[model samples]
Target: MLRIPAVIAVLGLSALTLAACASSPSSAASTSCERTDSDASVLDFAQASGDFGKPAVTLKAPVYVDSTTYTDTEVGTGRQITSDAQDVVFSIAIANGATGQSLVQAAPPVQPLSSWNSSYQGLVTAMMCATEGTRVVAAIPASELSAAGAQDLGVTDDQSIAVTIDITKVYLAAADGTPQYNDRRGMPSVVLAPGGRPGVIVPDAAAPTELAVEVLKKGDGETIGQGDTARVQYTGVNWSTRKVTDSTWENGASVAVAPGSKLAFAPQLVGATVGSQLLVVVPAGASGAGGDAATVYVVDVLGIDDPAATN
Candidate 1:
């Protein structure tokens, strides 16, 4: 069975280095700016019209300070970010603190919050605990930017980084991989909630005599092989009661799994394709947990993280 902890480590490591901001700074620094408490008035932000994912951002020059600070110009009424691994989608505009000149504007303007490296203290601090639909302005300390990071933004080591982030949506990280589709019958039917959470309706007949696996949706990405890690969203229903006992969707996060791990669903996921949705039925006595009652699971493969390549 695949363990959730192992999967989290793998997926977290793979996504840790993704950067949402553009690679190159927009302008040269004219002077050094001092860091101060977060003051939204000091930085004027003009968001683009149309889709929230592709908002155009305009902000006034901000004064950089020693400490990283942020303010929520608009608070979101949606879900709150509770974990580092929760995928945060937002549009960001980065600028030089000293000159208030634009630095990097993410072209599509939407990316996962975890895409940013943890070394970026300011970015992380600004985003933590923020809810979806919130608009934030953060001032990053110059010390927070590494020499390489400063170079990428075409700023001197002494300059701070200022940014405006428009929170769009937050989603759990999905698992990945790909394979041909397979068709099967007599499996439990599935209905999805508005948020993509699945509702599994088990048949009224007796439980299957053996483990039954069905691929409801096949992905077109990488393949999950032995030792490869996968991130997934899933819900488990006890056959006898037809009640959901466990769910990543309810918890608002995805789980990682590797083949041969302790996770009951690991073996089934080993050969599944990324982006595939699976319905698995484990017979009561066949289940490893002291021959517990049968359980039904609806699994969505979101992404794959190869341990060999990541290590």
Candidate 2:
């Protein structure tokens, strides 16, 4: 996958590129400030240098799509690529460089997007179509982004952006290049108690302590035996505050944990058993909370077929 530092790399290059353009006396303008027709050499350099531009979205998994127009967004530290819009949803964790003595570490996995209006679809769609290791640019009009997304991106009306996507790796169980599980949408809404999370607790008799779950997606018929790898989509929040400090919502991705690690998922979880729900309290630091405290998780098993995969 494109390394996280790639974002900084692209920004750095952008500065240099701007300086270079500003110094050169081109036909009409001095700076390559606006998106212009890319010549063969510029396109070739983008392909070789792994410079996607802006902030590129690197695909950890192969993205499948019918037809979508995407552009190069940005590059990672290793010069990885990223892309722009499409309606694909999947979650991923991004760790900043210099954490844990590593420049770029694998991030948490996320859930996949299936609905038409899923918040993450546009970004995913743009990344899915990009060639592996090559950065493609997408020019998205400001109106296409959500209000919060637009504001966060500093977007303006009639303004277009350059979204770079680098294909670091594409994982698919079959030759057709599609995920084993299909995306889901419009699930039955579950109301949460005043504590905030999803699903209400029954205070009456037979109040169950165990979690009740609904299976949404099935893995590739592989069994999640001991020592196997698993990716799960989860959300964690303070029981008292109900404020979600961490979530895979933006990417629809999951976290890969070992079955025996402090943050491991039970290895025995597999097959139709893949989507089975397990209710467990988030143990302090495990949920990004430093001390011993209670945290709730609503997890969905996305992949359980690979035992050696890094999330």
Candidate 3:
């Protein structure tokens, strides 16, 4: 969630060799179930050039997009981790001989860089605590599909991905002595104190809730303009009864809150200032709640990724 204007995306565009390898029958046969155990030798051989240290910790069966699994190593080191509530974003590279490396799939902290671009911030939390050579794999489900972590996963509805992370180095201070790469830097924080509320948040602190929102992918040199999409996540609950009426956070559910949907609003919704909480009151009759009254939505703008900006 930290906004690092200086964060650079190095063009590490190697041809997608592994994708090509996966399509080869010979390659497939060579790495099948019969070779699962021996495969580690080959995998290790490919990964040998890299001195990725032992995992500080490992997480098995970490779930990603809907049933997708990261049932392998999800390791990290003290250097790979920070004591911040927000996740840490590491400089990742492929292990020496490994064919491909990916970011684990999950919300914020767990998501790999491949799935987490500037516009999206998947789940955020404490990650692996391993040594320098630690290697981890995580599953990334598209936003529409991570049933429990929809908002944090920040994907377009239903896009699934897998990622592996190998921390190359960790930094403690900036040139000015400030911390440099944790995920929470420069991002907004949730205010749970008296009379304070964020514009958008998990509908239920305990349950999953997804709200449809537009992201500001681009801005005209001036300000937010037409054609710019505003990114947001939301949830709805009955105002009077406080019962959840509907949600976009559920897996396989629609991810758009367009004009005809239960939550309707103007097309000019994008470009709204970040952190401006929105309250949408849906009348009871509008949703056939019988005499149950209406529902309300509280929204908060987490971050904005201007699509038109030159990276």
- Give the worst 10-residue stretch by lDDT in candidate 1: 24-33
In the range 1-311, model 2's lDDT, one tens digit per residue, is 54555433323333223323332111111121232233222232122123332232323222222233454433322211122211112222221111111122122222221221233234444554333344444333444445544343444444433334444433221111112332323112234222122442322232122323343333333445566665554555444454554554323334565566554224324333343333334444443333444454454443453333443
Poorest stretch of ten by lDDT in candidate 2:
23-32
Alpha-carbon RMSD of each model: 14.3, 15.5, 18.3
Using lDDT as the measure, which candidate wins? 1
RMSD of 2: 15.5
- Best candidate, TM-score: 1
TM-score, predicted candidate 2 vs. hidden true structure? 0.34
Candidate 3 Cα errors over 4 Å, as ranges: 1-93, 97-224, 247-262, 265-268, 285-292, 305-311
Q: TM-scores of all models? A: 0.49, 0.34, 0.30
| lDDT score for candidate 1 against the true structure | 0.60
Segments in model 2 whose C-alpha atoms lie over 4 Å from true places = 1-125, 128-200, 206-223, 235-253, 263-297, 304-311
Model 1: lDDT of residue 111? 31
